[model samples]
Target chain A: MANTTESNLPGDDVLEEPVPAMQQLLDNPFLLLFIGIAVPTVLYTIWGVMEIVNLPIAK
Target chain B: MAVNRNFRTCPTTGLVFHEPAEKLMRWNAVVAVVALLVGGVLAIGVLLTRWQAVHLLQADLFYQFLTAHGLNMLVFWIIFFEMAILYFASSTLLRCRLATPALAWAGFWLMVVGALLNNYAVLRGDSSVMFTSYAPMGAHPTFYAGLILFAVGALIACFVFFGTLVVAKAERTYHGSVPLVTFGAITAAIIAVFTIATGAIILIPTLLWSLGLIEHIDSLMYRTIWWGFGHSSQQINVAAHVSVWYAGAAVVFGAKPMSEKVSRTAFLLYIFFLQLASAHHLLADPGLTSNWKIFNTSYAMYLAVLASMVHGLTVPGSIEVAQRLKGYNNGLFEWLRRAPWGNAPFVAVFISIVGFGFLGGISGVMMGTEQLNLIIHNTLYVPGHFHATVVIGTTLAFMGLTYFLIPVLFRRKVAFGNMATWQAYIFGISMSGFSVFMMGAGTLGAPRRHWDISFAGNPFGYEFPATAWLMIALMGIFGVGALVGGAMYLAITVYSVFLGEKIQTPDFATVSAKRGMAPAPQPVAVGATGHGAGVGAWGMVAPGTFVLALVFLTSFVLYYFVNWKYLSTVWPLK
Candidate 1:
């Protein structure tokens, strides 16, 4: 078993830095929510891959 | 950067260093690359075969490629990537170093070796029984070899996780109890041990049989035990998804979930009930007793679902509290309205959970029912159900988390903005469309894995789900969009790490607690400094060497043992 140690590094108690304009735009919380929604949607669509790949293409 | 003094020095080592988060992010990126390479190969292979367009490869090669895709992309890549994420949750988030770095390396190497052996064995025309590897359809001896190696590696990784957590606890890195996200990861690691143990039990004996050391392993026994591993491993994915949610919420809301104690306890619940719930997968199978299936699928499975439900209720509940605290009180709906819409991680978390709930959860329940299972058993519907839960729910969450990792962990900048954002949406939307289309088509009765769906007259008669084939093709249009999105993501990430602008922010920041809401300020650079001696050399050590060593060990030891079996032993076959 490994041991845990408290960090004495700087910024332990400092307030979190402000999000820059670029980051503000980059942080899309809904995207996370969307991923949750997408899981079942994609899984249900597993057959799509089969259809396209399984088709009797002339080539 | 050298001129800019862009890199910070570690207090412990007095050497200029990359951020711990950056190191972890690099690890994740590499892992993602591996996953995509293997997964893409497998996906393409399946496409060709399903379309009956295997230009040159024979049946054996086709099956071999299929086996590789399933094992490599699905099991190997996902698990390894998950381990990297788990490590981040445990150490980086907590502001601590890994407890036993050596053990982590061991775990990583083991996994790599296992992956190599499995892939090589498959390519050699040895393994083709499908990822479940149903018994009696045994592959070349190397197939078992690869499987065993991989299982062992996974086991090692689990232990490394335990070691990391232990070190953190001992160091007083956390205040009272572990954070909810880390707690979830720990629970997942514990389950992984049991899952891998089951996998090894079945695969080892099969290996022996393949090498002619034993007459044969009971096919039924192998099936029973393998599923114990197979199904349970998926629960581990579930555990990881939940962890991502907590972490994602923290990033976006500056809000911790309500009742940290309850959330942590919920994670522990997963460890207890998760692995035992594998019976849910066997409900439709013929050999299991009806009572056994009923108890396992209905009752046992409920406990696991209940664990998830607790989190489901709690996480959103906490998010609600957080938003209120952030002062988004136009009304209850106002909090949701005010929530950050642009935070990538937050969106990923929300979307991932929703996917799991409506699509994954609904399908899971449907599949768990004894009677309902008869309908979806081998159809395109089954795959649809899993992709909903696993790919969209779990994999997508991990991807969102990667955005944070790039700047926070690796200290590297992201390549492009609109491109990354668009890629994420494209992938998510296409995949969602694909899954929904398949499930709907499945209800109409499209069989999964069929090479040709153009039957003369409906296979199921008027009850046939033939229209599903058309839906499936139409869905492919979305898949193309998804594939392009995936490519863009890779390109942007590569560009960010290697060529993106280099700017550093102080570690730790807060954003509004609402969903999809943009941060009020710029993203902060949250990083850590070691308390004791640190290894912060700007060493140019080759990471690929470790991967090579694993491959070498697997090939050398595996072939020697196999040759010994073939030469010295006689087959028990008639």
Candidate 2:
């Protein structure tokens, strides 16, 4: 994995640079997008499965 | 000198191709095309016979042609092309020599021989059981043996692909991560390994049963495990073709994924959740528990659907962003309208994206739903759904890629260029119609795999509505249109590869470029600083695609509700 650690070059005054929250989200939009799509889909699917489970099978 | 001896740089794409691996890839692709031709011919017969007006073949011949068509198209043609793709993704894309070239050749021949043997069995009138050779309806032993050999060969090719990846890593051929397209191929190859192994476990026993070494294979068990092989094979195509879609974006527009990490995660979701879709096949089987069916079809399956949705959004999203960066940011659809529409690869991939999503993706989810499956299970709708996916989605993508390969790999100018440009639209639109009409007929309860949908001469003859006949006739007409498009493709590719004028240098982009269109977009250096540096980084450049995604979601929701409504009508509550 590529990581962004503080460099020891000429401008080594800062210890660690914090990545902005918005930039972090921007960098990984698919993650948020996937979660958003997946959560509702998972919930709906679970509801569907429960409905099937609760149904009466013909004798 | 070292590089020139073993590798040649494609002047067009600037990708290095290891010499021996190039030969293997070419051979596999050529044979895949041959298989497609055979399958395409058989498709006409089957379609004509099913049309009712033509009623082209006798019952036995219909079954035979159907069996050959299904196996040749679904198995031999697609897998052979994918073997070539695996080699290209690993050895070519990674700039490494293919590991064990001799073993790769052996694997290729094994696949060829197995394909021939299976074809011979079908042609001999002994194995007309169709692609899913369910037990108790025994095919000749050679049929099972041929399939086994083919599976083993494919397994070897998968290993060779993995080995090439290892070599690439060891040789430091590529820096940073492997390309996203290569990553997607790896996902497909992994799923293929599992699919082939399950295929072997089931098929070897079936072969023995055919040879009288074993007695009484369980019918339910056969159906149970066979789908692990059957449906999972299509899963392999899904992963591979999605990889092609990404590759096409990169090749044509030099587009990068919105987020490589996110895209890769979606692929991982495929590996985990996609195979469970095999359960949808057995949903109506009495022996299986509803819990098993419901869990696999609903819960786990939706994760797989989500993965596809992620891809569906990002692929076009990447293209939209790339186009916006190139000053096509006028309106919501300016980026889209300004796209190189006449470009074969662009048209093919774009059509594949839309058709797969609307026809294949939506119908698939609807059919996989338990109650909805009750409505369309074992009907022609099943084939309708897959035709959209496997044919429109995968085959069309492969066809698009072949245009690029002709000059870069085969070193010949694409012949009949105008035909190639129009071929994607003709084939795509016709197949889209075929799927829609077939599904419509299936909804009216058209029996799949029957010699006659009319139920002619049965002891208990039943009449279908007039609309069912109309839909089926339209399906047949559209099928012929698709066949014409297919023929044009074959003629263009065959002439280009074998007989067209040789070129010292070919401009790859010109194969798809139209006169008076804007010049081909310069390849952009992705992942550079400031590429995604601003407030607009949240895919604001791809607002068109974002709206398209919303439309897709709306379509999915409405379709889901409508299916449930249809299901409610099927079995009314007291």
User: What would you estimate as the lDDT of candidate 2?
Assistant: 0.82
Candidate by candidate, in order, the iRMS in Å equals 16.8, 15.4
For candidate 1, write residues B1-574 as lDDT tens digits: 1111112322221222214322543564576567666766566656455432232345566666667777765687678778876776666555444555555666676767777777777776657777888767778887788777777867776666666566555554454445667667776776677677767777888888888888966554565567777887888889988888877766666556656656755665565556656666666554556665676567757667777766766565556555655555343355667767666666667777767766776677666777666656677777777777887788778778777666655556666666666666777777777677767666556666544444435555443544666677755655556566667666776677678787554653322111111122223532211111221112312122223334534654564355335333333433
DockQ of each: 0.02, 0.05
Q: What is the C-alpha lDDT profile of model 2 across B402-485, one tens digit per residue? A: 998998889898898678889999999999999999999999889897988888888999888899899999999999999998
Q: B50, model 2: CA deviation in Å?
A: 1.0
In lDDT terms, how accurate is model 1?
Answer: 0.61
Model 1, residue B14: displacement in angstroms?
19
What does fnat come to for each candidate? Answer: 0.00, 0.00
Off by over 4 Å in 2: A1-59, B1-5, B506-539
TM-score of 2: 0.87
